[model samples]
Target: MIKAKQIVKKFESGTNVLFAVNHVDLIVPKGQFITITGRSGSGKSTLLYQLGLLDKPTSGDIELAGRDVINMSEDERTFYRLSKLGYVFQDYAILPSLTALENVLLPLLMLGLPDADARRMATDAMVRVGLEDKLINYPSQLSGGQQQRVAIARAIAHDPEILFADEPTANLDTETSDMILELFLKLHKEGQTIVMVTHEKDYAEKADRIIELADGKIVRDETLRRN
Candidate 1:
């Protein structure tokens, strides 16, 4: 449900300009799990950020659910991000001071939902990620996998249309990474729209579609069917 056309992003360092994304065009269909794969400095994260409306392109256009975001006001973009998107990071990005359930409820709180209803939604989301028993646990009390599940729960608590994950398995061991990817696959089966940015090809290959980035451009795009 997202479309980008000839997106370009550049950063300035003193007198030099570095292009983070160069004339990239992409479309993320609804109900599909897509992955963007690239090495460090390949601009995968920049492209994801632009897609999520967290950042704007220097010269390009993006549309979400048929709405052109490049022309939206700042507040409009902010509202859309809060209402339509969820994010997961390699670091988990959970509040250390909050319980898993509470962390999941953070986004609902921002939406001004009643405390009881938010907690219920949070609990349900945590359960969906297989973290129901860890609701009362703090981030430090949980394993890396559990923490990532909490992040996932938080991201989906509001039933966002799209989830953007940046290097989701980078901080975990191989086995834990596998579990996380499996969880992602499960969510996709449940019709969650996801756009993941990862350096791991195995993870990207697991997605329904893979987009490869190099020097800020998409060099390859492939679609696959799972056996």
Candidate 2:
């Protein structure tokens, strides 16, 4: 569903150019759950931003579903992202004032979905993430895990072709993190395409494939046995 060739993202600091993401090539097939794992500065998140169209690569090409996204204008990219992609950040990016259901409804409403249809979709998404009962709760009223589930529901409400999660379990405890990972696993089983960036090997192991990064390059790509 996504392909990147010789992707490079660089930043200029004084006279030195830092390659946040060095020359990298990747392909993510439809319905495949992949994880990118590396140390803090290994460019795992940088590569993800490039692939997810959240950031443009300094050089190289990115193709999603066979169309080149690197050349799209900012407005076009925004539309594409809203229509086709979903994201979950390390921090639950939910609004403090919005109810969980309303948070999920925002994107759908942005897509011009009717209020009633949006509500139904949002409710379904919340249920899928085990947050059905927390729909009316505000972010501050929920636990960390519940807050993250609302974020997840918000991301998936539109049935995006692919879901991108960047360090999604970073803020939770061990048990909560496990629950979140299990939720991701459940989504994968339901054929949701996912590309997650995580520092934990244990979480990465749960994915269909794990791509390890080092110095902004892919050092290992392993396909795990799906039991």
Best-fitting candidate, measured by lDDT?
2
- Model 1, runs deviating above 4 Å: none
Candidate 2, residues 1-227, lDDT tens digits: the string is: 99999999999989999888899999999999999999999999999999999998999999997889999999999999998999999999999989999999999999999999999999999999998899899898999999988999998899999999999999999999999999999998988999999999999988999999998999999988553
For each candidate, the alpha-carbon lDDT, in order, equals: 0.92, 0.93
What's the C-alpha lDDT at position 188 in model 1?
93
46-107, model 1: which lDDT tens digit per residue? Answer: 99999999899999999988888898999999888888899999899999999989999988
Q: List the residue pairs that clash in candidate 1.
A: none
- The per-residue C-alpha lDDT of model 1 at residue 203 equals 92
All candidates: CA RMSD (Å): 1.4, 1.0
Local distance difference test, candidate 2: 0.93
TM-score attained by model 1: 0.96
> lDDT (0-100) at residue 36 of candidate 2?
100
